[model samples]
Target: MGIIRTTVITGLLGTSSAAAYLAARNPVISPLAANDPIWASKVFKKHNPSRNPVTQDVCIKRIPFSKIRPELLQNDGPLALEFCRGVWSGWGFAVQRRYLDFKWRGPETSQHLWTNEQLADSTYEKGTAITDHFEVVDKTPSAITVRCGDSPRNQALRPSDGLFEISATIDRQREEVELRLKSCLFSSQGKMDGVKGPMPSWMEELHQWYARIWAETGSWRLLK
Candidate 1:
């Protein structure tokens, strides 16, 4: 397969045409952070090995309190999780990865398909799966941490895994709630253990750009 086609297939997450419309409507979804925060360093260490380097990217947005429902004001965590869910669900359904979604949700799991309101109201326990590949590994009042591994390929390349986190902080003083999306990607064990793949510079750049677009789109979806 061609590099672009292969890159899309191997992409960390899928995006929708709707996201493009969202981006065009609100070109500046959030303020882009130059680098990941200090707290992210500890999170990366816990999931990945010290030998393998991890790339981190973060996008931040603060929603005004007036925009949020009065009932949701009690806790920032739930709202954060809601935004996280919106992001996950949008990405999954866009690519129509229903088989993967069903396989991960399992027959016992109720609400295989979650609506925006459902995502906002539901509580995600540890091990809960969203977007097929993303599993909630950690959940706290303020943040939700999910992990996903790329599908195996026929080539001798090391499998890649992405650790994504969504965090919400209520700023009563500022009268706005802040939501952050942090993504960390690393190569997992395979033929290229401890060595990064020789991905073309263009592909790497494209992936990063794609991720940013997804983040912006996801973040914006929470408001609508």
Candidate 2:
């Protein structure tokens, strides 16, 4: 019994070490800044009044406007769509999707999972559901915000309801275009109240790690 317990402990430690290494290597996702203007936006203000520390996160990439395609510079719609396509398609996302499928919590309709040309027709209007898991909750000339993870198909699969957003906008002060992915998880009460039941630390850490990997690889693919 002692030997068995030692072996199990060793295996668990090895797994945790590997996960930590991966997260450190790809640290892209980060906590949203306290003073970020998004907090003032009508959409964000409505959902996260207290700014629950455990529930919200953002991933960002900044690229010089000169490097951005000229056609996308003036058109926020195309820029957002293209970036989202890149966001959902990459080796990182592919690996995550496979894991979800293996766990039997993945999309029922594989055809509707990733980027498809049909998304090009999005009107970017409020309340538009796209690609099954994402819905456009807010749209402005400068940004588009989507609420993710509440789809009827995946709700049962997820431990909590959450939302994720992809936004691409010009940052005049920096002379760059900032691409950002934002996410928030809600308690069962349909509120950002972590008090109801806090997520396990390991769960949150795993999620952030995968998010960072996906963001890093996706941003690289977008630029390429």
Best by lDDT: 2
TM per candidate:
0.63, 0.61
Q: How accurate is candidate 1 locally (lDDT)?
A: 0.56
* Per-residue C-alpha lDDT of model 1 across residues 74-99, encoded as one tens digit per residue: 78766777667666555523443445
- Report, for every candidate in turn, its global Cα lDDT versus the true structure: 0.56, 0.56
Model 2: per-residue Cα lDDT at residue 198 = 45
| lDDT per residue (tens digit) for residues 14-97 in model 2 | 576665654554445545676866667775555444544335667666778777777777766667766665656555555444
In Å, residue 148's CA in model 2 sits off its true spot by 2.6
Q: How well does candidate 1 match the true structure in TM-score terms? A: 0.63
Q: Candidate 2, residue 160: CA error in Å? A: 1.8
Off by over 4 Å in 2: 1-30, 35-54, 95-115, 119-124, 152-159, 188-197, 220-224
